[model samples]
Target: MGDTFSSLLELGGPVVLILLVISIAALAVILAKVFQFASARVGRHGLVRQAVTQWRTGERNTAAQNLIKDRSLSAALVRNAMDAIQMLDQQPLSSQERDIREERLREEISARAADRLFALASWLKALDLVTQIAPLLGLFGTVLGMIDTFQTLQESGAAANPATLAGGIWVALLTTACGLAVAIPVSVAVTWFETRLEKERAALEVLLTGVFTAGSSSTVAST
Candidate 1:
């Protein structure tokens, strides 16, 4: 078994190495994207909550510029919501209609939040694409290896060269294994993130609630 494995490795060494390099590259991209998403999400969510608090308190001291520092999507959402709140504040809608107006404002803010979160979800989709691509690449490599094995068999004359055919077949199978190794882990991670997406949607709903409450309080204060 050990000798068979060693011979197989020797046959597919170059393909295995190439697969390793590609897998490492894909893993690095995924890690960097995840880190960026996490950092921005945490930072921007905190800033949004702070801005909502100040807006609720009727604090004249808070500017959107002062509240949201970066050009992140989350910051854009908060800025847009604040603008909506300002516009609503200027309206002459009656108290009975105010609740409907408040619900509209909340939905608008939630939409902004969903858009930002959707951008983050794109990274997971990219990882999923990589998973799908890896297996196809492995299959291509296997097909090429099989072609080479059959050629070697035809050239062997009357003497059946078992070792040559076995080596080629092993090389082909190894590509499949290598491809699956990269694909399985990536797909699993994508699945995990997919499940977490609903949790994130809930968080955005909560944040929007806070923003709407703040907006409604402002309306009450003016009345």
Candidate 2:
């Protein structure tokens, strides 16, 4: 395997080398993101939903306790919003003051949700750049190889060998193949990661809304 890789690098030249480095980096980023999503339990929201249901039924302390061990982004935002609302309820404020406070709390929770999502989305742009440029880089390498091949052919004049030209052409095209190899997988990974992020974002919005709405409903029923 090492011999094959070295031979490929020799044939593909600097462009192939760059692509190899990029592929390794992209793989690292993908693995890291996978671990991050798993650790945060990105899509596993059953517990969070249960907590929200508890909150809706006026079991505020139980709702908060249910989420105490949850580490998902949605759980964090829900906890914060729940704590904020609980604090707001404890105060002796007029109806107008309560409305103003609730709006401010929502904004603060939204901002926090954005920040958490942003953190999850870190290093995504570098992968995107790789997807965009890998093919072009391979093409650039192929073009350079072709130029060199033709230059050699020109120097050979009448003695230019057809077999040599054929060999040169395939070797020149190797960079382009390598580029696509790097790019296709990276593109797919980026797409998957992006889809997950969007889902998480939507989930956070819904969960927070439920918290606030549930709190309001509970208040209305009591009054």
Candidate 3:
């Protein structure tokens, strides 16, 4: 292990360090996501269950308080829904006004969902940047090795055999291989993380949809 790392350091220290940093960042992201989405604990916890409970009972304030108590990515969406429902329930309204209120609530819900999406996009962009640059840096190492090999050839004249210059070419080959290895996995990880996020978002949507429809149906039946 030590010898391999030493070879990498000597051949392309900057590229190796950059890839190391990216790998750390990617690892952190994956761990965070695993914790956040695995058991529905991080984002769901007490608030989401309470939101569903409140919807069943038509108690918007209970849902709002539950939402306000927590600050996960899902909280904003629940809070938006609670506030919109409360606003519509309290307002002096003709039927036209009620329709307007419902439309406004839909818009607010979508707006809240939009808020945390930028963070996801930023994470994906960082991974993509690393994926793009790793191969190029590896290619740079290969080019530098070729330059060193040619320089040695000039100094040694016809005396140097191809076997003598193999070390430099080997470094070039290894760097390119390492770069590709780093890039391919990082790109795949980015895709996998995005898929995880998509599933979580879908869950959130389903939770909200069921609660909203149940709440509205119960309200109408009571009226």
Which candidate leads in lDDT?
2
Angstrom error of the Cα, residue 57, model 3: value is: 9.0
Worst 10 residues of 2 by lDDT: 214-223
Q: Which stretches of candidate 1 lie over 4 Å from their true place?
A: 1-21, 41-93, 206-223
Q: In angstroms, how far off is 128's CA in candidate 2? A: 0.3
Cα-based TM-score, every candidate: 0.65, 0.95, 0.72
Clashing pairs in 3: none
The 0-to-1 C-alpha lDDT of every candidate, in the order given, reads 0.70, 0.91, 0.69
Runs off by more than 4 Å, candidate 2 = 216-223
Better of 1 and 2 by TM-score: 2
For residue 94, model 2's alpha carbon misses the true position, in angstroms, by 1.0
Give one digit per residue, the lDDT tens place, for model 1 in 1-223.
9897566557666666666777787788678767766765533466666766676677523736555575555556667766676676678878778778777767767766777677667767678887998887777778888998898788887786888788679878888888899899988878866766666676556655665666554554684
For model 2, residues 83-139, the per-residue Cα lDDT tens digits are 889888888888899999999999988998898889889999999999999999999
Candidate 2 overall lDDT versus native: 0.91
Instruction: Give the winner by TM-score.
Output: 2
Report the C-alpha displacement of residue 217, candidate 2, in angstroms.
7.6
